[model samples]
Target: MKFDKAAGENTLFDNAEFVGRPTHRIDGPLKVTGTAPYAYERHDVVEGQLYGYPLGSAISHGLIVSMDAEAARNAPGVRAVVTTLEIDPLEKGMNNVARLFGGAEVQHYHQAIAVVVADSFEQARAAASLIEVEYEKGDPADYDLGAAFERLQGSGEMDTDTGDVEAAFSSAAALLDEMYHTPSQSHMAMEPHASIVDWSDGDQMTVWTSNQMINWNHGSLATTFGLDEDKIRVESPYIGGGFGGKLWLRADAVLAALGSRAAGAPVKLALPRPFIMNNTTHRSETVQRIRLAAGEDGKLTGIWHEAASHALPDGRGEDATAQTPFFYASDSIRAKHHIVTMSLPESADMRAPGEAAGLMALEVAMDEMAEKLGMDPVEFRKVNDTQVNPSNPEQEFSDRNFVECLDRGAEAFRWTDRNTAPGATRDGQWLVGHGVAGAYRGALVLPSGSRALLEGGKLVIETDMTDIGTGSYTILAQTAAETMGLTLDDVEMRMGNSAYPVSSGSGGQFGAASSSAGVYAACMALRERIAEQLGVEEAEFRDGRVIAGDTDRALSELEGQIDAVDSIEWGDFQSEYQMATFGAHFVEVGVHAGTGETRVRRMLAVCDSGRILNPITARSQVIGGMTMAVGAALSEDMALDSGRGMFANHDLAGYEVAVHADIPEQEVIFIDTLDPVASPLKAKGVGELGVCGVAAAVANAVYNATGVRVREYPVTLDKLIGGLPAIG
Candidate 1:
C-alpha cells in the first residue's frame, strides 16, 4: 500500500501508476493450509449430503437401448437412481459449446449415462457399479488425424493471398515449406471438475464448485435451468487449476443439480479420475502448414499459415492465426482454419489456446528459415520486425520492444555457443545448443464491476470474482488498500459469490487488470464521497483522511453517512487504449546422441506485462506457464486409440505433464511499463505470458544439436533417431 514518495507508479496506487513494485499474493495461506475447500467438499453448507456417483458408457459412440436400476435401487443405503428418462431434462448451458449429454446418443468414450445417489461416497460408488445398462455399439470415427486430415473438404478456408504467391516463390532466393502437427492435450489440474448442489426453501438453489468464470456461468446456468437468475447462487472461492477446462459448466454441475432436486437433499458429485479426460473438455489437436518465401536479403515476401482441426459437430475454431498477422512485415500473408466434424468429446480452450499451438509451428518455421539463410535466428526476426499490427495498420501498438527482448535474451544466453551449422557443437556424448524465441500476448480488458463498503475506516470490497488460485485475493486486496490509502490488512476482500455484482472472471489472462480495475473504479467512488463529506477538494484527498486550508477530517468519520448511499460502480476505459504484454524466451539444451533424449540445461524469460501487482504471484504465474510450454514442446501429449476413438491413456499415469525434475533453472524478468488507457493501476495480464513462445525455443535447440527438422509436438525421440545419420 505504500508508494515511494519520489515515484508515483512504483507502488499500488492511482493512474497507470504503482506498476513496478513487488507484492505478495493476498490468498496464499488459505490455499497452502488446506483450509480452503474445493467443490464437493463444501461440508459447511449441506448436512447429510447424498453423494452421487456417475456411470459412463463402455463404448465410445453408441445408443443407449435401455437402463435398469432395480439392482442399484436394492443396493444398501441407496436414496435415488436417476437417468435421462427420470430426471428433469436439462437445457444445455450457454457456456457449453457442445450440448451437455445431448439426447441419449453417446458422443465419445466414457460418456456419463446415469447417476446413483447414496448416504455415503463409498455407498454411492458401490451402488453405481450395480446398475445394468445396454448399449448398441457402432463404429466410431478414429483418431487417425493424419490419414483423415488429408481428406478434409479443404473447404472452410485455405488462406491463399495478396501478391501472387506463385510469383513470389518463383522469384524469391530463399524458400521454406513444411507441415507441423500437435497432439490433443488435457488440462489435468490438481482438482478435478466437481460440484455440490443444494436447494433452498422453495425455488432457490446454491452451487459451490471450482470454476474460472463465475458471472458467465451464473447467467448461463440460469438460462439453462429456465429459472430466475436471482434464485441461483454460485460460489467458487478457490480453484485447483482451470487452464481452460473449467471455463464452462461441466456435467458435474448439471447432474448434481438434477440429483439434488430428485433426492430431496443436497447432492455432491465429482468426476472420477479416468472419466475426467472423456467427460469434460480437452485442448483440440491441430495440424498446420507453413509456406514462406523470402528475397535474397532474407526479407519475407510471402507467408501462409493453414491450420486444420477436429472438434464435436458444432465446436468453435481455435484460430491459430492470432500471432501471424502481427509477427513480421510482409506484403502478402495468409492465415485461416479448416475444421472437420469428428466423433469425440468436446474440445475447448487451454492455457494460451491459439497462441500456445500457433507459436509452436510459426517459431519453428522461422528458425528453419533462419538456418537456411545461415543467419542468427534472433537477428532474422528483428530484421523483419513490425512496429504495428500488419492486419490493422491503423491501430498501432502502445509499445513494442520485441527487439530489445531478443537482444537481451541473446546476451544473457551467450549466443556465441551456437554456430550457424547444426551438429557442429558437442560436449562429450551431449549435443549442446542455445536457442531464442519471441513471446507475445495481447492484454484485453472488458467492463467489470464491484461493490464495496466503508465502515469505521475499515474498507470492504465485494465482487463475484474468483481467486482461482491465481492470486485474485491478493491482487484485489492491493487494489482496495491502495485506493483507500491504507495497509493491505485494512482492506477486507470478498469474492466468489454470485450475490455480488457481475465480474470478469479469471480467463484469457484478463483477470488481474480487468477485475482489479473494477475494484479501483469502486474505490474511486468511495474517495469522492469521502472528499465531499470532509468538505475538501477531491484531488487533495490522502492517507485515509482529507485536508482543506485549515480543516482536517478523518476518512472514517464520513463513512457512516456515505454507507447509506447506493453501491459504487466503474466506467469503461478499455475502449480507448490497446493493452498487451510482450516477452522473449531463451534456452540452453542438451541432446543425448545415443538415446536422442532432449534435456533442458537453462532457461531465461523477459516479460513486459503492464504492471506487477504482486511480484511473488507474478513470478509463480510465469514459471507455471513456462513449465506448461516446456511440456508441450518436450513430453506432454494425449495419445489416442484410433480404433476406439478414445484417449488411449485416459488416466494421469498414461497422460504425462511436467513434473519438478523436468524444469531447469528458470528465471523470469519483467520490463516495467504502464498504460493509462487500461485502468488506474495499468496492470496487464500475467497468467499466460510464460507459455507464449516457449515451444519454438526448444524446437530451435533440437535443430541446433542435431540438424534434424521436426514439426510434430513433444519432439519425441523417435523423430530424431530416424533423421540422424547413423549415430553411434
Candidate 2:
C-alpha cells in the first residue's frame, strides 16, 4: 500500500474503537511484575553465557603502542580477551561516527580498547583491570567549542538564506540580538546499553540488545562483523529507555559479539554507567547567535540564526537552525549551522536533536524580542504564525494548529493572571512569574513493513518496530484491532525482531504512526484476501465478522488461517506539504530572592500533532519529554573536562537529571485534528514535540521572575545568584 495521496476516510477514522481511547500499555503487567526480559536479564535463552567487561582507553587521544594480556588471559576463569590492536579496525557502522573498536588509534576518552570474557562479571572486571596497556600519546586535542567556533566561523557556507536579513534588521522598529549556549547532555537512560550475543551457531549470530532501531543494528552488525545481513539477528523486545542514545549500534553489542566469537559461547555485556557516557553518543553543545527584528505590531520582520556546534572529525554538528526557517513568518531569514571538529566524545542525537537545542535559543529569543516590543510573548508568536512555510510560500503545512495550542494552553494555564512585571509579585522570599514558548518538530513518515497472520480468529502483527517505552505494543495492537474490527484482546503483537519485516523502529517518534500504518496495510491486505475467499467483491469487517452484500462469515468460520504481508511505501506528499508537529509550552516558576534558586510551580503543554493514537501513552510520552525538558532547562549538563577531552561528571552521582522532587505537576493537552497527509492514522510524532521549546519556556519564566536573563543553559543558581534582585 502506497501512501502517496492524502488519506481518505479509513477504518481508523470511521470505526475507531480503541485508536483514540486512553489505552494502557499492553506490556504494562509484564513490566510491573518483573517478568519482562530486558537484554541483560535474558540469561535463560542461552546456556553458559560468559560476562564480557570492556576495557576503556586510558588516554583520551592516542595510539595503543602495546598491550600485554597474558597475565589477564591466564587469570581465573578468563575465557577470551580481544584487544583493539589484535585486529584491524572494524568497518564503522552506518550510524556510527566514532569507530566502536579495533586498531590502535583512540578517537575519544573511554574508547573500548579491549573486552575480557569470564565465567562471572566480577572475574571479567578483575581480569580486565590486570591487562596492561601502553599508548603513544598524541598532541593535545582541540576541546574548546568557543575557540573552535571563532576559528571555523565563515569557513562553511550558510545552510539557508532568504531576503536581505541585514537590511530588514536595520529597518525594524525593535530588535533583539543575543547569544545563547547549551551544554552537552547525556541521555541518562535508566537502562544502560546492554547486549547478549551468541555466535555458537558458527557464522549465524544472534544478538539480544537494548537498541532502538533493530533493522539498522542488524545491518550495522553485519557490516561491522564483515558478514552477510541474513546471518545476524537482532532482537530487542524490551528497552528500558533510549532517548535517542540507543538509536545506533554501540560498543556493548559489538564487543559481546567479538567475545562470543572468540570464546565460542554466548557473551553478555553491560556498559558501566560511567563508560556509557563517553562510550556512546551525547547531545552536542551549541552556541547560537540569534537576531530577531520585529515591527511595532510585534510581527517579525527578519530572523537570523547562526549556530556553531562541536562534533568529531567525521560527524555533523547539531543543526540548531533547523526549525527557524519554517517555524514563524519572517520576510528576511537566514539560518546557518557551523560544525567545529573537537576531540570530545561523539556528540550525536539525543531526544529532539536539532529542535530541542535550537528552540532553547530560538524561542527564548522570541520571548526577549516580545519584551522589547512591549508585547505579550504569546501574542507576538500568534501574530507571526505561518501556516505556510515561510521559506517557500507555496508549501503549506499539512496541519498546523499551533495557534490553537497556544490559546488552549494559555487559557488552561491562566496566562492572564501571571505577574506582568518582574520582581513585583513576591511571596516571602519567592518571586513568581509565568512564561511561554512555541514548539515545533517536523513530522516524518518512513517506509515501514509488517506481516499479519490470522489464526483461530486472532490477529498477530509482526514487525521490527521497538516499543522503547513509548507504548508501541498497545498502539500497534489497537491499529490491528481497529483495522480488522476485532477487540484489543484478539490482537497479538510480536516486535523488535530482525526476522520480522523491517519497520521504522523507535527513533524520531515516527515508530507509532509508520509502524501502525504498516500493520494497517497488512491487515487491509488480509481483509481483501478474506473477502476474495468468500466470493465477495468487497467486505466490511465488523464485530469479528466480514459482511459483504448477502455474504456474512465469522473470521473463525474460515477453513484455515489467512496471512498477508505488506508495507507502506511513502510518496512525495512531503514535497507538496510541509508536515510538522507544533505545541505551546506554558510554565510557572518561583525564584528565591537571596539564593537565586528556581523552582517550577507547574507546567502545561498543548500539542497539535494531528490525531492521537492512544491518549494514555501519548500523554505519557509528552510528560516524559516535558520532564526531560526540565532537566535540559534547569539541571542536566555533561560537564566536559577540557584537559582530558571527556565528560567530567560521567556518572549519575555527578551529573544531574530531574528527579521526582525536582519536577512539579505537568499537564498535557492534545488538539483535536487530523493530518490526512501524515499517514493513514493521521498521527504525527508527539515525543520530540514534547521536548522542543520547553527549555525556552522555563528559561523565560526564570527571567520573568528575576528581571535578569541568563543565556547559558542549565540556568543554575550560580549563573543567577549575582544578577538576581538584591535581598529585600
Candidate 3:
C-alpha cells in the first residue's frame, strides 16, 4: 500500500484495539534481569577471542613522528600491536571525515593511533602504556570562537531570503534584536562505544557492534575495505543507548576489525569514557542572532535568524536556521547559516540537531518580544500562528493542532494564575514564575522493509530496526499482534541483524512509525496467504481463527506455514504538503533570592504528532527528551581548553546531564489525531519534538522570576546576579 494523500475514513487504524493502548516494554524483563547480551558481552559469538585496547594520539593536531611497539609486542601476554603506520591509509566513512585506523595525520585529541591485542583486557591495557609515540606539535589551529566567527564563510545550503528583511525590521512597531550562544554538548549515553569482530574462512567478516543504522554501517565497512557488502555482516541485537552518537561507523568498530585481523584472532574493543568525548562526534556550538519585527497587536511582520557554527575544514556546519522559515507566520523572513573552519573533531547530529539549538534562541526571542509588547507569550504565539507554510503559501499542513495543544496545555498548567509582574510571587527565599513556548519538528519517513512468518501457532517478525532503549520491541510487537489477530505473547520480534531486510533504523524519530508501517504491509500479505491456503476468496481473521461464510476454522489448522516480505512504498507526500509535529511546553521555575540559583518546579507538555502507536513508550520518550533539555538549559556544556585545543572536562564527572533530582514530575498529553499522508500507521514522530522548545520555556521562567534576562546558555548565577533586583 502506498501513502499518497491525507487519510479519510475507513483507515486501518481507525478502530485500533491494541495500537493506542498503553503497554509495557517486551524487552524490559531481559534488560533488568541482566540476561540481555550487549555487543561487548557476547562471549559465545566467537571462539578464542582476544582483547584490544586503543592508544590515543597525545597531540590535538599534528603528525606522528614515530611509534615504537617492540616493548609492547614482547610483553607478557601481548599477541599483536597494530600501528597506524603498518597498514595503508583507508578511506573514511561517508558520514565521517577522520580516517578510522591507518593514518599518519592526527585529526584531534584521543584519536586511535594504535591498538594492542592480548589474551585479556588487563594485559592489553597494561601493555598499551608501554608503546611510546612522539608527536611534532605545530601551533594548533585557531581554537577561539570569536576568531572563528570573524572568519565565517557563507553556507549556501540553508540560506533563504524572501523580502526586504532589514527595511521591514527597521520600520516595525516593535523590534527585538538579541544574540544567543549555545555551547557544544556531548551524548552521555550509559554504554560506551564498543565492538566485537571476527573473521571467517579467508574473506567473510562478522562484527557485533553497537550502532543505530545497520545497513549504513555495512556499506561503510564495505567501502573502507573495498569489498562487496555480502562479505560483511553487522549485528547489534541490543543497544544500550545511541542518541545519534552511534549513528555512523566509529573508530571502535573499525579498529576492532583491524586488530582482529592483525592478531589472527577475534578481538573486542570498547572506547574509554574520555576517548568517547574528544575522539567521536559532538554537537557543534552555535552563535545565533534573532531579529523579530512585530506589529502593536502582537502579530509578527518579519523574522531573521542567522547562525554561525564551527566544524573541520572539510566538514559541513550545523544548519541551525533551518526551522525559522516555516515555524511561524511572517511576510518577510530571512534565515541564514554560516560555517567557520576549525581543527576540532568532526561535528554531527545530536538528539534534535538544528532545532534543539535553534529553538533555544528563537523561542526566547519570542518571549522577549512579547514582554516588550506587554502581551502574554501564549497569546502572542496564537496571534502569529499560520495554518499554511509561511515560506511556501501553496502548501498546507497535512495535520496541525498547535492551537489545541497550546489551549489544552495552558488550561492544565493554570497558566493564567501565574504572576504577571517580575519578582512578585515568593515562597520563603524563592521567587516563582511560569513560562510557555511553542514546539515544532518536521516529520519525515524513509522507505523501509520487513518480513513476517507464521508457523507452529506463532507469529514472527524480522527487521533491522534497533531499540536504543526507546521501546521499539514492544511497539512492533503490538503492530504485528493487532494485524494478525493474535495475543501479544503469540508474536515474536527479531531485529538489529543485517541478515534481515533493511529498515529505517533508530534515528530522527522515524524508526517506530516507518518500520511498523512496513510490518503492517508484510502482515497483510501473510493474511492473504492464509486465505489462499484455506481455499477461500476472502476471510475475516480474528482470535486465531478465520471465518468465511459459515466455514469457520482455526488458523493453525492449515497443513503448512506461510511467510511473506514487503516494503512500504512511500509516495510524494512530502512534496505536496507540509508535515510536522507540534507541541506546547510550560515550565514553572523558582529562583533563590540570595543565590540566584534556579530550579524547575513543575513541567507540562501537550503534543500533536498524529496517531500515537503506544502511549506508554511515547510518554517515556517525551519525558526523557524533556530531561535532556533541562540539562541543556541549566548545566550541560563541553568546556574547551583553548590553549591545548581539547575538551577540558572530557568525562562524565565533569559534563553534567540532568539527574532525577534536576527534573520534576513531567506530564505529557497527546492529541488524538491521525494523518493519512504520513504513513499507513497515520503516525508522526514525537521524540525530537519534546526537546525542541523546552529550554526556552525554562529560560523564560527564570527571567520572569528574577527579572534577569540571560542571552547565553546554561543561565548560570554569574550571568544573573548582576541583573537581579535587590530584596528587602
Highest-lDDT candidate: 2
Better of 1 and 3 by lDDT: 3
Candidate 1 per-residue lDDT over residues 660-708, each given as its tens digit: 8988699887775665544557567878878988988888888888878
Model 2: residues with Cα > 4 Å off, grouped in runs = 725-727
Could you tell me the lDDT of residue 326 within candidate 1? 70
lDDT by residue for model 3 (1-728), tens: 57666656743467766787899999999999988899999999889989999998877788888999999999989988999888878877768777877868887888889999999999999999999898888675776665555455334654778777778888899999888888988887899999999863467789999999998898999888777899999999889988888999998888888888888888999998888788888888898888899988888988988888878867766767878998899988888888777667778878888899899989999999999999999999999899898988899988889999999999999999997887888988998978888998888788778898998768999999888999889989899888887878989999999999898889987888888888888888888888888778667767877788877877667666689998787887567888888999999999888888889999999999998999999999999999999999999889988667788788988998999998877999999688878878789888888898999999999988888888799888788877765841
State in Å the error of residue 328, model 3. Answer: 0.6
Model 2, 658: alpha-carbon shift in Å? 0.4
What TM-score goes with each of the models?
Answer: 0.93, 0.99, 0.97
Going through the candidates in order, what is the number of backbone clashes in each? 4, 0, 0
Candidate 2 or 3, higher TM-score? Answer: 2
Residues 1-728 of candidate 2 have per-residue lDDT tens digits of: 98888988875555688888888999999999999999999989888899999999887887999999999999999999999999999998886999999999998899999999999999999999999999998898877777766676556677778888989988999989898899999999999999999997789999999999999899899899999998998999999999999999999999999999999999999999988788889999998889999888888889989889988888976889989999999888898888888777888988888999999999999999988988899998999998899988889999999999999999999998998987778889998878899999988888899999998899889999998999999999998998898999999899999999999989887887899889889999999888888899768888999889998888877877899999999987667999999999999999999898899989999999888999999999999999899999999998888788888898989998888887769999999588999998888889889999999999999988888898999999999888875733
lDDT of 3 at 248: 93
RMSD of 2: 1.1
lDDT winner between 1 and 2, please give it: 2
